[model samples]
Target: MDVVAWQFLLLVNPNDEDAALQQFAAFRAALEEAGGDADPAALLRDVIDWKAGFHVGEDDAAGLMDALDELASRWRQRIDWGLDDDADAVPDTDAVLQTAFVQLRERHYSLWTAETGEATLSGWITHERDEEAMQLVAGALGLSARPGIG
Candidate 1:
């Protein structure tokens, strides 16, 4: 499926057109890399950090926190992980992530997780204003994703 530039723009660059355009170029190149038939799921990793996104092992709570913190810092914000960012202090990776997701929502940022079929969680963050349209964006790119919590 060929996703339009505008749609890609919305998904990666909801607030900055210039940045979105830059990413769109990279996204297009990524699509072209597979002879114009690349799997969107696979292409996600390449495009993730172009703006902000993460893919980490399920049990790597510290890594997740670090990735999230880096993304948040890009926006001049921080996540209230509800505790110190020590992996041991965190009871469950799920709970720590759930809390971060909630905190992100309150800041107009949406954190989404996708099923990876592995012992890992992968997803991206978008502005809250774009939250409602994220699933559609995912569909257009042929990705199955949802907001998950535990």
Candidate 2:
């Protein structure tokens, strides 16, 4: 039997409401240009509802996931991985993990809001399996194939 993967919830920071709408428009245009039969207005509605913690239907969910995955893939490709000698060096794994945590926290604050304003994109992923999901995310992010981490 094939293992199922839990869908990953990707939270993107669009910077503001205008940017989010623009991004959604671009996605809609691309889908239309590709002859996709999905309704752009409905898709946008689902995305808006998604931000409010509502469950989108399977087809719409899949479409949103695909759009996010494509965006992430493009962004990942643009990353420049290089180590600078002048950069600060961490002394140990614990320090590195701490630093990572701090960064993640900072990012969360920067990308999320508590008021009625749009500055970020957030969604959830659900699946019966965890390992498969991790693998998929690793592959999507262009990381080496290492098990047990997402």
Best by lDDT: 1
Residue 86, candidate 2: alpha-carbon lDDT: 75
User: What tens-digit string does per-residue lDDT give for candidate 2 at 1-150?
Assistant: 001111122223222445455545555565567465654323433443434222222234334333333333332322111226575542332232233224333333111111112322233222223435545653453323322111
Tell me the number of clashing residue pairs for each predicted model: 0, 1
Cα distance off (Å), candidate 2, residue 14 = 6.1
Off by over 4 Å in 1: 1-6, 84-91
Candidate 1, residues 1-150: lDDT per residue as tens digits?
445445745565556777767666776688888775677666655576535677788998878878878877766778887665454575467876787788888888877777767788777777777766887877666666776551
RMSD of each: 2.8, 15.8
What TM-score would candidate 2 get against the native? 0.27
User: Which one is best on TM-score?
Assistant: 1
lDDT of 2 at 28: 55
| Range of the 10 consecutive residues with the lowest summed lDDT in candidate 1 | 1-10
